[model samples]
Target: MMVTNLCTSPSSTITLRADEWVNITTIPNKPGTKYWVSAYVNVTGGTISLSMYGDISASQHVSYQITAVNAGAMSMTYSVVSGSPTVTVTSMLICTFAEYQANKTLLDSIEYFDGDTMPRA
Candidate 1:
């Protein structure tokens, strides 16, 4: 149920280094469980590629998703695929599992989870 959200301020964003892979803060993980990852990024000055999440175009606002298999403080990474410019990361989330179950009704309006392998039981 631990959610590790990456962002500086409500109106600010993160800048990714050019030609390098960046891993935001890690999130809690449990083996044999499925976790959801979501992010809103602005890829400017280059094409940013994420690890298993997907890629974004220059000056685009994109939302991406990915699932994790690693346990204990897992991290999601992004890289610049083409241009030598950095990517602007708006908001990100490493959430799922317990938290979603506890807040099922409250969060249902926000996002939905299959919960089959979420460790809710």
Candidate 2:
């Protein structure tokens, strides 16, 4: 497994206005693998506008969301969060998974590097 740094906002900072949706960045989705998205938001629990396309968004706010696409890219957006009208994201992670059984010896290194988290996308 490997965790990859896909994209970040300019200077790793973004401030979203009330009810505003800002395009954070885009990520590529390779075939035959899953992506684990971890976003570091200023607020603990707030509505982070994350979805594939537009129809897949959830009703409530969530800090993280997973995307499973065949072969293409996804546009990420940040909208609103709870309690506060503005939200700032310091960083984000887009990790891809690689089977460890293929190489038993390398498992140790992967474990040390990511601790169960996938490495670079």
Candidate 3:
């Protein structure tokens, strides 16, 4: 089994202002490929806006992106963390299209069953 490491920044912190989009980090991306990103940002307050592109409003935050369509940038942003202006990005993970598909295939092979009936021990 291939192991994927979680990207963590235990001691790192970033501040975001209310109603303003702030660039957080950028992930390496490949053109013509898709990516699955999971960002774990600790926040407490009014709201938090996150996106992969700049100029995104709070209502425009997105979790998935196609690299080619967005000019191959995997940047991240946070519009606000309100009551608490600072936040810690506990962990994050970015999975490429190929890696996602490979994992999907592996999982299916190991856990999927065709019949409706339960398999006997």
Residue pairs in candidate 3 whose N, alpha carbon or C atoms collide under 3 angstroms: none
Number of the top TM-score candidate? 1
Model 3 lDDT tens row, 1-121: 3424212331234455455534333433456766654444555544555545333322221235335454433444466534444444423344565554666665335342211131111
The segments of candidate 2 whose C-alpha lies over 4 angstroms from its true place after superposition are 8-11, 17-21, 30-33, 44-65, 69-84, 97-121
* Ranking of models by lDDT: 1, 2, 3
Q: What C-alpha lDDT does candidate 1 achieve relative to the native structure?
A: 0.50
The global Cα lDDT (0 to 1) of model 3 is: 0.42
How does candidate 1 fare on TM-score?
0.53
C-alpha lDDT of all candidate models, in order: 0.50, 0.43, 0.42
What is the C-alpha local distance difference test score of candidate 2? 0.43
Ranking by TM-score: 1, 3, 2
The TM-score measured for candidate 3 stands at 0.46
TM-score of each: 0.53, 0.44, 0.46
lDDT for each residue of candidate 2 in 53-83, tens digit (9 for 90 to 100): 2222233222344545555553345444344
Q: List the residue pairs that clash in candidate 1.
A: 1-99
| Top lDDT hit | 1
Which is better, 1 or 3, measured by TM-score?
1
